[model samples]
Target chain A: MRAFAHTPFGALSIAILRGFVRDRAALFFAVVFPLMFLVLFGALLSNQDQSEIDMITVGDVPLLEDLPADAREAFETTFEVEESDDLDAALAEVRDGDADVVVEQKGDTLVAHYTQTEQVKAAITQSTLKAYVDGANIAASGQPARFGFAAERVEDESLTTIQFFTPGLLGWAIATSAALGAAATLQGWRQTKLLRRLQLAPVSTGTVVGARVAVTIAIALGQTAIFLGLGAATLGLKLTGSWWMSIPLVVVGTLCFMAIGLLAGAIAKSTEGAVNMANFFVLPMAFLSGSFFPLDATPPWLQRVSDVLPLKHLNEGMLDVLVRGQGPSAALVPLTILAAFAVVVTLLAARLFRWDTA
Target chain B: MTAIAAKGLTKRYGDLTAVDALDLTVAAGEFVGVLGPNGAGKTTLLEMLEGLRKPDAGEVSVLGEPAWPRNRALQPRIGVQLQASAFFERLTAREQIHTFAALYRAPGSAADEWLERVGLVAKADTRVEDLSGGQAQRLSIACALVHDPELVFLDEPTAALDPQARRNLWDLLADINDSGRTVVLTTHHMDEAETLCDRVAIVDHGRLLQHDTPAALVAAHAGGGNLEDVFLALTGREYRA
Candidate 1:
């Protein structure tokens, strides 16, 4: 009976992990679901930067044909211009969503007809046409163009939207599923009196809770690796910083979420209640933390709210290493914040843990 | 030597006392039965003795160590089967027993041996959630005894079993006691107390009313009927609920 003192806790943890691994639903959440999102968001966003507006020109847009070399080249590159002798046919195509816009010249005025659903494409098409027309008008007036400019990409290599979203997606996967999984697992154990039964043994509650947390962190790491591997292989994800920097970041992120889950489980009356409470926290955090979009695009007040959130730090820290190529130093602040969160929530969970079902 | 000794064991929940200043003792190798009606504090008394619960004001020693308020060192020396045993949903019967065995650091029977002893060898690989109530009860016994502890506490172990299954379990308990290990159990069945217990303790309102052999109890209080008559005479004919 006095063999290895730590064997019981380790065994209990392994047994618990085995149960989760064998559950199909758990496996789907831990592995399959995140990969599905990676594939979807990767394919959808990777092509966004390279997309062009398909336009058909009607009437004599002499401004387009007489543009300066640079302006003409820019217009050609931004739009796939197709000359149409029949204006009615071109307008029909634009209305039916087959074409993005139709450019027409009426006397001295230029008109662009576009569909509202294709607002972004239509806006870009209108701006480019206006710039070309203004340049042509200045040239026709026999005056030097007030200013000439050419678009140039600042980065050495253009970045795909997939590269921008990969790290954030990885954070989202751990923050959403791992947190919910931990809460549900703890709540289920309590509901089924498994915790009560374990209390009968000589093992301390700390050992039991620690083992479960270790399993959660392991699963989180696995989720990160799978997402990164899938993103790199399929979505052309470029790793800027040392990938090893992501390991600690993932651990810190997992601890932060797991602690929140523990707190939720401690307060929940049942397994169902725990899941509901977890969703209440995870769903909003997934959005506000910049998991799916940039927090910079959000209002300044909302960004301030997101800055204090652990997931925001996690996503931004991950983006630093995976997207921006920032080194280990970039993750220091996030790790500290997450560690603080872990300690606080863990203490609260310990205080609230109940061995009895009641 | 006394396997269990309790002095002024009192436990209360809010305003209601579950186990009042009760005192009891059981010697080594004795088969003791604790009989009580619903809400009579039988489970509470047993739990207190097993160290699963703390007494409001009392001292309990089990297996030669203080048992109340928790004694980790004594946990491995005693086996406990709660009234409602719950296990991990995904673990099989054998796996569940192995889990407890690991926790106890058992040096005795292996998980398979315990499963065989409990007559569940054929169902060892079946998931716990798929097991019937009687099968789960039997599996709980296997888990409790897997460590081969010197003292075993069984609370309503055969409460949901059929007549044959109950008889089989009774024989198993008899065999366990015959091996010279102490066994303490609580039940509402008078026949179970008469047939299995060397001494029976009857309790009501968190107090011990009587403690004696079945034949002596019947003789003194049965009015020439049986142990059931003695129980009804003491606890009354009114339903506990």
Candidate 2:
């Protein structure tokens, strides 16, 4: 038992991580790729007031004559409506910083114009128009109508996009790094006949495999740390939970992904084949696991498909803690699924793992 | 007491029979070689004996323990050097040996001495990826012997070496054998078998064709000329693959 306890899992993992860090190219892909995605997406999603038109202005309109008083009030509440002296001036406001959209009454029809990009302006106009129309209908029917849905503003505690993505990226980094590292290591060993040499020794296959997995986990943790630090510094991703929650999530993610890597290494007949297999598993998981995008808007069937991926559970667990400020107890389902994934994949890898080249 | 013994050992891979029913035995401290052609199942036989592979229909005893899924207690007592055992590319030769040594409860401090013995002392700090092929092979042997096991298995230890390196390895093997440990090696090189092995087992298509002292086999088959002719006679001039 003591001999098994000292089987180089920890040391081997550290060495593997060091080797990965030493490789600048691998480090960039493993750590920088997902971070780049986070920063790019975060900037796109940030609510900073970069554009000039934060409000829309109206001109040449009898305010409450064409629409009911209640409808007009609903419109005013929904949009920051400004009154301008002339049509040209209102259009100018639309073009300049004052208005996001200009609603000018030409005879009876309202012409909405804005310098805001089509997508942004269109979304604002659609929501405001819907509220105004609904309010008008409610006034006609003599019923009270709400203008906009109550902004369920639960304290200012929601995690930023970066915070939500950081843990997912951490999971991705660990999985890909471990899978690639273990597969490549195993292939190279097989090519050099090092595995065959070890086979002849008193060392069990389990020991060799355990060491490789340990090394992979260590490398993965290092990759995770690098990305987490970068996300915190550059993207302001925060971890609301204690280290207990974070560390175990990282460990479970590492074990599950390392198992994937071992299976790839075991099944591949050659180094090139192993590389292809690694890509086959890593690439799809990256996209489908909601690592880069939200799965909320995706179809239900797609979400079910994603549920089978180890990254999905990892990402959900991370989001639960970092994004939702929930404890591990809330993340129990994802954690359990991830643990099962780790155990199943590891057992399969061990069974399928071959030491000989053939 | 016999250090190693095999009775009707056989192994098959799907449609191909890698090793046929064969019987062999080696007394303690005897240096034996399994010499055959490229696909003669020499490796398969060695793997079976080392507990890396299970025999299809035979029994193997190594130091009074069955070889397959080897008894844990008997593991530290046996050393094996595969023809192509791999090492961590990032780990230096010394670190690799030390890591393996740490796996055992009681290990020896012969890693540095073994490195020096194999002429790899200067390259001790070199990673396995950076070492030359011959250096890597030497390091593999050093790793196997670091714990000072009583029985050693060497499989094609000198397959792709230059003449000087090969001679050096032969000398190293001779020294290892001289330390009064039993050695069972496999090779395709008849000269290696003739020069290094006290007794040689000639196998073909996984079956034992002949087994005897080098001189006795040659005298019995080649009229006392050379082991190569005896090997050619045992295994015809046909490509394996």
Query: What TM-score does each of the candidates earn?
Result: 0.89, 0.79
Per-residue lDDT for A63 in model 2?
A: 32
lDDT value, candidate 2, whole model = 0.75
C-alpha lDDT of all candidate models, in order: 0.83, 0.75
Interface RMSD of 2: 3.3
Error of 1 at A310 (Å): 2.5
Q: What is the TM-score of chain A alone in each candidate?
A: 0.81, 0.72
Measured by TM-score, how close is model 1 to the native structure? Answer: 0.89
Off by over 4 Å in 2: A1-26, A53-159, A185-193, A203-210, A241-244, B104-108
Chain B TM-score, structure 2: 0.94
